[model samples]
Target: MNLWPTYRCAGIKVVHIADDWSSATVRLKLGPLNRTIFGTAFGGSLSAMTDPFFTLLALKQLGRGYIVWDKAAEIEFVSPGRGTLTSTMTLPPEEVARIRAATSTGEKFLKWYATSIVDAEGRPVAKVRRQIYVRRKRGSC
Candidate 1:
């Protein structure tokens, strides 16, 4: 089940997912349902829009032999998010390799990734940091 479309009700739209699962772009549109009383994007919506991406991307790249989950997250609102805002999640190949190497012995790996939510004009609205937990499943590798 692809979570991108499933999360649309929250005003989060998945704009793109790279073929390699190394990158993804998601947009949070400012609408009645997702706006605050100040007419800006709701803070909760901004946080929710970024909730599952890092873990999901890692899961896809790590394959079935690995277990991945969202361990923690933090969002700093820099400015009121007006109009449509977007954030791109990217995991470099080196990072993936490092994760794999670290978890090769069935140990857990926790890595933090950062992304910026920017407005239509490309100004920063918020900064989101997500820590993902990953491990190699026992007997699978």
Candidate 2:
């Protein structure tokens, strides 16, 4: 995703996505393109760094029989972000199981996940919450 326009332009780089699709790490550099007037990380960039990760991880783990979408999101700024900031998203095995069981009967479900964007020293810069929508595809149950 480093080359994706939205991420590239905002100075966000996807550092790692686990082989099993259970976790992903993203980084955002506080550069001119993504720096606020206050000389901190731009709020939009901080938020963008977290978007799409949870949904992507869920979809990959759920397979073709399931449909997953990013239903909603919110970000709370905790402090000024300087230098490079990192965020990691993880979908636990139990949570994946829960999602599968919930939609096994062809029911739709909504789940919320949280992550934090932190600076190089591990100070939180923002807290993000993402709501994911999931369901079994018709005839795929």
Candidate 3:
């Protein structure tokens, strides 16, 4: 599914998505619709920008034989976000291997990933942590 248009209309842009679904980069541009009363980036938008990447990446790596879902999330506002804010989510091959090994027996596994939203000048604006739940399907490899 194409989410770029929907997110971009809300001022969040999906700048890049890897062919292998191992990484993705998103940018949120400060605009009237996405600005808070103080004229900075809205907290909800910042959190929303980071909402799906981890789960999506995990699902891709684990394939259809596994169930992947966003279990929980937390965001810390480190500074007032301004200008174009960017965050990149990555799922390294090693991490993918770990998840597969852990859930190979059809047991559930929870994994956490962290990403930082940065301003155009590369200053950290927010820190986001996402926890994902994964389990191998009962009858699948």
Local accuracy of candidate 1 as per-residue lDDT tens digits, 38-98: 9999888899878788998888888999989999999999999999899999987778899
In model 3, the clashing pairs are none
Name every residue pair that clashes in candidate 2. Answer: none
- RMSD (Cα, Å) for all candidates, in order, is 1.6, 0.8, 1.4
How far residue 138's Cα lies from its native spot in candidate 3, in Å, is 1.7
Q: Which candidate has the highest TM-score of all? A: 2
The TM-scores of all predictions, comma-separated, are 0.94, 0.97, 0.94
Candidate 3 has its poorest 10 consecutive residues by lDDT at 1-10
Model 1 bad stretches (over 4 Å): 1-6
Better of 2 and 3 by TM-score: 2
Ranking by lDDT: 2, 3, 1
lDDT of 3 at 105: 91
lDDT of each: 0.89, 0.92, 0.90
* TM-score of structure candidate 1: 0.94
lDDT of 3 by residue, 1-141 (tens): 335666766699888989988999999989999999999999989998888999999898779999999999999999999899999999987898999999999899997899999999999999999999999988997
Query: Which lDDT value does model 1 have at 34?
Result: 86
